[model samples]
Target: MSRIAYVNGRYVAQRDACVNIEDRGYQFGDGIYEVVHLYDGRFIDADLHLARLERSVKEIRLGMPMPLASLKLVLAEVARRNRVSEGLLYMQVGRGVARRDHAFPNTPVPVSLVVTVRRVPPYPSSLDGWSMSAITHPDLRWARRDIKSVNLLPNVLARQAAREAGAGEAILFDPATSMVTEGAATSFWIVDAEGSIRIPPLGPTILPGCTRAAMLAEMAEHGMRAEERPFSLDELAKAREAFITSATSFVKPVLAVDGKPVGDGKPGPVARRLFEIFARHVKGAPRNALQ
Candidate 1:
């Protein structure tokens, strides 16, 4: 089947999608993006993704190309065009084309918007009790990791380091703090010995994960308290279990970090419970406000 894409104000064949070479996102990586998961032809966390899109534009001082409601409609149409019943929808808002310069482009230029859809295989039946290897990489990213910008060279290198280490993800360690901040693409979390969920607070070092927030809500129903705190590199090996959260993978278990087993090298009970709760919610979760 031919894929479809929403480029700026129009929908076009994916193979024919194109943007100006001078688009800041292409030239200087000046843009923000979000990935919304599609399940059974329904959109998951649509509101949260839109909210984050607004936040990203605000933080970067980029004018939204259209209203949030309009964008939502467009996303739904893009999904329909692509016939993506279970997959991902990606949208990026870039600073409109302008003269090449490091400083902010002229404020009045319209922001660029592009939406693309791709298929994601069904979630595995038994991803539980899985393990992943991770090596500490220096956190040298800019001070605005909170914004979902496109400047991902640092993230690219960090993930490559993790890939080279024969691991599923890269857990970054900040040089100044000597601790774990987050994974290259997913949010990091660990089940403490006392059974509390631990994650570094959202700051310049961590992207605000939409799935992470949903997991926290799911935790309350499961009687788990999610804590927003930085975890030490040494604490990884001492945790009961570890996992990651993202729109694409949902929940991924960490069997090991740096070759050390996490919680008997299996998915912990808490992580699995949360995953089950999250899965149920995603399948039939109410509107974002209810979620």
Candidate 2:
């Protein structure tokens, strides 16, 4: 079946969807985007995703293409048209098309909105022996990593580096401080020697992740308090276990980093437990329960 996409204010065939050639998102990477996971025709952590979308748009000084309520409706309609029960919904908002120049246009143009949905495999039944490898790269992104902007050249390079190295993701760190920041496309976390969950605190260096937030809440519910603090590469080398989180990857265990085995070179207890908790949360918990 042909896919459908929401372009600007219209729903059209994906092949026919197009934006102005001068759109800021295309010309200057002046835009923000969000991806929400869908399961059984229901959106998971949608409110958090939309909230983050609003934050990103505001961070870039871009106007919302439509009101929040309207945007949600549009997302639903797009998903419905695509018949995507288990998949991802992507939305992007840009500053808008204008004449070729470095600054905002003298006359404000309506922001551009694009929404698309596609199917993906269902979540794994268990992560017992499942694991992914990662390679470390120097964090070369702009200072405003907090915003989910389309400026992802550094991320693209890092991810491609990982791919070439036979790894699934790239962990980025500050070269000078040796402090771990985040993955190119996910939030990084570790289970320290003391059995405590540790993740880098929310800051300019990391995008505040919805799945990361949900995992923390689930951990708290299970009497596990995650410490929000930066850990060095040397520290990570000796960690009991490691994992990365995102809307798509969920709580994926990191078996190795830069070709070095993590923990016992297997998915550890902490990661397994969190994965189970996260899975249950997404499957049974109400959307409002997360908020």
For model 1, the local distance difference test gives: 0.84
Residue 116 of model 1 has an lDDT of: 98
Per residue, candidate 2 scores C-alpha lDDT tens digits across 191-241 of: 987787899999888899999998888888999889999899998989999
Which clashing pairs does model 1 show? Answer: 129-267, 131-255, 132-255
Q: What TM-score, computed on C-alpha atoms, does each candidate reach?
A: 0.94, 0.97
Which predicted model would earn the best lDDT? Answer: 2
Using TM-score as the measure, the top candidate is 2
- For 174-243, candidate 1 gives per-residue lDDT tens digits of 8887888888888989987777789999887789999998888778777878889888877776889888
TM-score of model number 1: 0.94
Q: Where is model 2 more than 4 Å wrong at Cα?
A: 288-291
lDDT of 2 at 268: 88
lDDT of 2 at 287: 82
